[model samples]
Target: MIPSGHPDAPKLSPLKQLHWSKVPAANTRKTVWDVSEESIKLDFNKQILDRLFCSKTNMSRTGTHSTLRNQDKITIVDMRRSNNIGVLLSKYKLTGPWVVDIINSMSDEHLNKELVTALIKCAPTSDEEQLLQSYTGSKNILSPVDQFLVEMLKVPKIRERLNCIQYKQSFDSLFEEIINGSRLVERCCQWLLKAANLKQLLHLILNIGNYMNSGTARGNATGYRLNCLLTLSNTKSLDQSITLLNYVAKIVSDRYPHLLITSDPLLEAASRIHWKELSNHLVSLQQGMMTVQKEVERQQSTVGMDTFTTKMNQFIKSRLDHLRDAANIIRGVEQLYDTVMKYYVEDYSSPEEFFSLLHNFMTMFKQAHLDNLRDMENDKAIRPKIVHKAERIMCQRSLSTTSLPRVSLNLAPQQEENQDTVRSSAAAAAAAVGSNSGSSIQTKSKGLIKNFKNIFLRKR
Candidate 1:
């Protein structure tokens, strides 16, 4: 590598020389000839090596471009003014006067997304703003675009105005999405109340619990909390091979087959609704409107901002009406949710909690149903082997009846032991069922009235 500041070496860096060496000799010769002809025609500098080695960073650091760099105080403003401003405006087909017109008129039709984004990025910083404001030089010395930028920065809250325009452009579509979400909440409430199959399934779960808790203190309960549904999967048989959820699914399939078929399309969507996030969106919408209103008032007091203020005034009026409608819809949804909670006699903090509980129960129930079917299939596959073994043993006993009398006598004790084992297993299963049922019932009965009242009053 060549030393960076070596005076005796050629002006070109070793890196550049290596790059040029790789180029075909014919092309290099033609390029040099072209440069010489151009120099003769335009009276350009003859020091081609010096020109090739020169770069903006090298010139700025050495004060070679002092006129552009302003002695050593190089900044983003200087870079933009020297290099980027003209290309940016030309590429976007914009002129200084046209940009001023667009900003003053607040015409979103002319200000597309890309242009707005670029303007936002180009907003002057605090230091740049101070520098531009302090400059008392003749405006004639600055380019038209640079002069426009200086004047534009003089307006108060220019950045806020640009951001407000972007928000306004997207406000309608965003508001519509929020409205649709509220409507979805309303539909979920309606489905919970009016779905016949869902009601029947809950009733079935209640009956199953009552049957399991027979002869215990919780045997005769008429109602249970919705939260108890989540515990069904936790209540397993003594061997841990079957859960209460499995039993419920098996019974539903054998008896009320229609309950297995979910016709309501809203369950999946409702299961995913996050009430807190939805609430936050509503809050943001309100805050955004207030910001827009404040901007409009500011514009109304300023001269030359009449067109923007007028346009925003109309926008605010229409949006306020839409927001009022949305408010009514939200209120109706809350009322519906309150009614559903009352009808079910359940206490939940939010709609999301209630829907999520139900969603989880349904998912577990489906999985248990699938497991039961698989077990039945396996049992079917094993039945033939069991039958063949039993038949062979019976034939042996019949053929050697006289000799096997002693064998039969010995087998009687084993048969009794097997029966005892079966009985113990049954007792253990009943104990599990009773324990689970009692715990769920106890949990449901505690703090019922207080929680229900708190949740209901909060909703109101």
Candidate 2:
């Protein structure tokens, strides 16, 4: 943390502030020791001086103190011009204790003609450089801005700040996500591979699809698109009362119950993640691990960083590296899923789409099975009534056929005798009417009587 009144105190972005809010406390239970950089500048300066003196003694025959002085000046100049070091200073902020240590550690032997030359370029023009020179006092002509930038370029100090600030927390968060995401993907893959029910479901659908397309161009298709499962409910039976899917569902429920159980394990997988999303997570994890590895390497080479580096290395080996094997399994799972999709002629190359497809199929398949059971129940309820009605119609037909012959033979002769009797009564009524008509009708009746008497006499 920067001190309250420091002029170079770096302002934090809202995003970075929020990120730091969730960071584990620095003093929490952790394996890596956070070193006290309370007097790092003084300590590092003494080390540098001791090293420089040893080098001077070793090269006493070949060079003077002037050569060593010139080498130190070149190092300071290189720091001032480095764009990478400049960027790190901007990103991590430069107002902390690390910045103070770096700035105060510099001495006149390290500052030389090149440092003055680089400082001249820090301002826009000669006029500004000269104007700024007054701020640092005449004895020390480098402007405050130039001096600040020069101090920030101290590689060892910057490295130490980076190592100390957020490395452990960042590594911990990234490693946890990678491990969890990889494990999820690996589990999903296992469920898919071992799903006995999913395999049978696919096989059943394949056979049905081929049967439906028999004698057509599609009859010999090796497999069907996974999306075709969605259309199963659309396959109408011959009577148009039920779908083909209903029949298949009934068969599965009754005959192949074991095959459907495979879907139970995959239930979580379908609900929780998509294939593409999981893949992307794994990729990000790989990149994050690589970054942590680079950070560890950087800190390992820096002097006075052994404790942090050792713990960090141990953490990676024990906790994070196992994810590499899981990542490999993820790759294999992707390939297998892709191959299965291709076999079915489905374009679903990602887990996201595939899981959704499977979900839809399962839902429809179960619904179809239930519907078929309902239809069977209805058929059972109506069968006895239909049978009773049919029997009643058969009995009525038999009675009508048997009575027809009896009506013709027994009733025909009686009908002829009744007709003859009716004709005789009509003739008697006509004779009575003629007797009451008077003389003309009486003469005609007498003539008819005489003719009848003569005919009776001849017959005798």
- What TM-score goes with each of the models? 0.62, 0.42
Model 1 clash pairs are none
Off by over 4 Å in 2: 1-167, 170-177, 180-184, 187-197, 237-240, 254-262, 289-320, 335-347, 374-460
Could you give candidate 2's per-residue lDDT for residues 1-460 as a string of tens digits?
Answer: 7653343443211111111234365664453443446535443343343443432232355543233221111112233444544454465444334544532343334333343233323322334334433444332233234555444444343433343333443445555555565566556655666666687788887887888799999997877667777887887888987787877887788888765432354554554665566667667655756777777787677654554466667766775655676577677766766765564466765665776777777877777777877888999999999987875554334323322221221235535544434334334334544445566544544454345334434433
List lDDT for all candidates, in order: 0.67, 0.53
**Candidate 1 minimal-lDDT segment of 10 residues:** 401-410
- TM-score top scorer: 1
Question: In candidate 2, how many Å is residue 11 off?
Answer: 32
What is candidate 2's CA lDDT for residue 86?
49
Clashes of 1: 0
